[model samples]
Target chain A: MLNPPEHQVAGHDARLGGLGPLADGSGRFFKPLQSCSRGDNELSFYTSFSSDPRVPPSVRRRFFPSFHGTQLLPASDSSGPKPHLVLQDLTSQFTRPSIIDFKIGSRTWPPSSPSDYIDKCFKKDRETTSLTLGFRVSGLQIHESGDAYYKPSRDEIRSYGHDDVRRIVRRFVSDSGLASAVYGGSDGILAQLLELKSWFEDQTIYHFYSASVMVMYDKEGVENGRSGPAVKLVDFAHVVEGDGVIDHNFLGGLCSLIKFVSEVLTDPDGEGEGRRMKAKKGGTENGK
Target chain B: MLNPPEHQVAGHDARLGGLGPLADGSGRFFKPLQSCSRGDNELSFYTSFSSDPRVPPSVRRRFFPSFHGTQLLPASDSSGPKPHLVLQDLTSQFTRPSIIDFKIGSRTWPPSSPSDYIDKCFKKDRETTSLTLGFRVSGLQIHESGDAYYKPSRDEIRSYGHDDVRRIVRRFVSDSGLASAVYGGSDGILAQLLELKSWFEDQTIYHFYSASVMVMYDKEGVENGRSGPAVKLVDFAHVVEGDGVIDHNFLGGLCSLIKFVSEVLTDPDGEGEGRRMKAKKGGTENGK
Candidate 1:
């Protein structure tokens, strides 16, 4: 966003047109910035992704949304000085697209389905027949308010809840050749995501003071097999960096959130974070 | 140091004469390498300070100690391997200068002296007469063992203690003109320190683990009052950069430690921390 000239117009998804008013077809998702975060880390997230040089171009566009810049809507009360931030609308605003505004600070479970897509993707044996891409969607909406950390509270999870959500959103392609041509391996994607995370850490040097993760993915495109969904961080603010290098409280909230995301992405099953980390033994993500 | 050529010899203290066996008359300090850190950061700190174009020469030499370079020593048992990092020993090693090792990870109180120096230096009022220099010495020493944190124990503090520690170790000169000439204002010193901290954070982008601060000064030399004691961050190891990005555990230990140090230094007299932070009316230590 800072280097190259801005794209004159946001890439629009014309396919979504006529589907509904919400489908006025902007480049994929249109998340409400206010609803995107827990009020913290919103501005910094946009500013960092929008400006920090360390964040490479590919990660900026592919892994994260192309920040279409920000806008300020008039305040409702008109007394306070904040209209807050109105980011490029990546929400299913005009049309309800089977969305789930998750209860703030909770991890939604993986989709379990009897559909052939899940069968092809979740096969324990690595049969390279499908060569599928599972863009697992999850994020840390948790905020560090006193002792309220980012974690499921007393809720035991189960893997047996059968659902057809796979058919609803995830895209499954049988042609391995075509899939390979269009999308990179999970290893590459994971590396990019991690690089983005590391970039975030470096910004903490001047002390970006907000702690919440905003991972968003466009289910509309992914469902139709047009593109592989991405996990992009959104909505960050309350950053007083450069001179006042202080995080009102403990700053480990960002570290904990990102680490959990890595764990979740690498090991979606019960608990294989250790094994999954070990599997990437060849410095698999280095050259990329 | 990584980029620039190593200094052939550590900057020496001419003041520490033939002070016997213990007084090796080395640069200033001789830290046990194993106890120093994991060894990765030690080199970078020196290399970065030694070479990075952004780091001013004064900061390179005065604020940070000169890197004498690394040495591989023979292990005592003669079986295991050991590489000793030969830092320019900056401790009051040769001259029994009154020093505080600060029990690795605890925040020790300031040396509340009843001496005339303390009275002059610690005067609460804005004594326009003495624009004194106070080299803040504080840092973190928590090893990445599980998720253990950095904080002091429940031991109560005291102001009075007696030992044969040389009184000449510390020099609290009240001359406003001399302090400004030798050392820039306190604001300048802080900006340099924060800049140094920022450099450390950038290196962490490649995952340099084990974060801490090590500040050292000269005892025999400061007694003569030739120069204000310089603050140097030392003894950090376990750093493997470039793509090996993984926080062994929580990573806020550094931020917490540094932030606390800034707090302690700014508010030396117990609970005035809140008030002191607000008193920086001007952008005194910024813009650099």
Candidate 2:
């Protein structure tokens, strides 16, 4: 039987009364297939991506969730059965997962998309921090310590400007006000993001639009030194073939996100004047 | 376009005038789906095995090929389109791969099978080394250090007795008259088989009958120290749920196979008198 994923911090949530991804208690995540075109596009991306020899094994293993085919399961909305993509549940190994989902790239819609869809995406991108910050926090759940947890609402996440996003990142790494154990070491989140950045810098395989980078770590596992952090690329419904051209838009946005993470690691406490000025300009545009 | 795999050493070969498996030139092996019941059974095994929390990650990653879902492609027999189970091509990384396929277990047919099917399987099992050694070499291709290769015919392989099987194994590890570089190290084939032995020793989730274990290595890669050996469990059409009981049939067969390989590693030159006696007894049964 499938149940709403407890560790899912972003995207559509069935717990809030909608069709969304479900988790089969045993390490499998089932995402309900969207509309025909979008679903086929995403399925095609995963199918071809798995067999693409151009993709390095390390990059594929560390950055993407393993695909396990698709299944027709009863819909969460009781609207008959629906085809769902089966994937490895990233948070299955964690006991108390702290997860953050970042919607990658400044633009969410492609040129080929319908004008109405483009307009809808453009409006959302402008209103959120996506236009000014290059990427925005879609949602996050910070497990500080013990039973205490912090999960910001959808509205709060959507309203986050450059400064708010930075603060949220800092809060995610606080870990009960101690040195965060998930972002500093040689194999930490920063290192992983850098590795992914390196791949994006060279790869010209596919252009991802409205994709997400999900960073997750278990607070208990980190505190106990049992496990480390993981980063995965998700939500590939808008992915398209790059046609032998560099994905400059994705690479640029990835660099921007990497910069934010690097700064958080390097200067955990210092709030520089330069950052404040940039945040102010971004905030002004967001306010407009 | 899918073409016949150049490195395939066993099973039904389309290149040899049969509807068998195809390789995508990249890294995918597409096996044509069989009869509905058998195909569904195999598919079900892979689907559940992938997500079964009971199976350790190490076992899943090392012993089984990563499944990339299934696709409907043109049949090699020109029998219209058919669904194919897509999987990681184990020999994709090798420049000159040497592969061996071993059909595991003594009893190939289940008790629930029809009388004619049982009789056929029982006759074959008794004819081959499966009844004696608990496993039989279904096929093999040994690349002996250069452009030279050794591939025994089906009739020759079927006629192999206990001593012949041992001789064949020794030839595979000879590597053009030198100590084989693919089977002795800490991470080599021996160690990998031992690791799989440990898992089968304890696992009780499923019973695999008539399954095969494929061992492959690139002779050139091993000579250059570029790549090592890989062992993957394949062909799950006859697998059945364990229902909380240990799979004694598979476990026993695995242990027997392990013993044979272990002896080859330890006494590479010494043919013990005890082994001669056992071979004589097994050969007597085969003659009967």
Number of the top TM-score candidate: 2
Regions more than 4 Å wrong, model 2: A177-180, A273-288, B1-288
lDDT of 2 by residue, A147-229 (tens): 66799888888888766776777777775453346777788888998898667645657888899999888877777878788
DockQ, in order, for the candidates?
Answer: 0.07, 0.01
Candidate 2, residues B48-111: lDDT per residue as tens digits?
A: 9999998999999999988988999888877778999999888889887778888886567654
* lDDT by residue for model 1 (B1-288), tens: 111111111112122331111123545333324433334555665565477675557556654556666655443333334554555655534232222221111111112223464345334211211111011122211111233322222221111111100111111111111222222345433344455544433332333222333432233344465434344544344433322222212133344334434443443342442233345434232111
Model 2, residue A236: what's the lDDT?
A: 94
Per-candidate TM vs. native?
0.34, 0.48
For every model in order, the TM-score on chain A comes to 0.37, 0.92
Error of 2 at B115 (Å): 80
Predicted complex 2: DockQ: 0.01
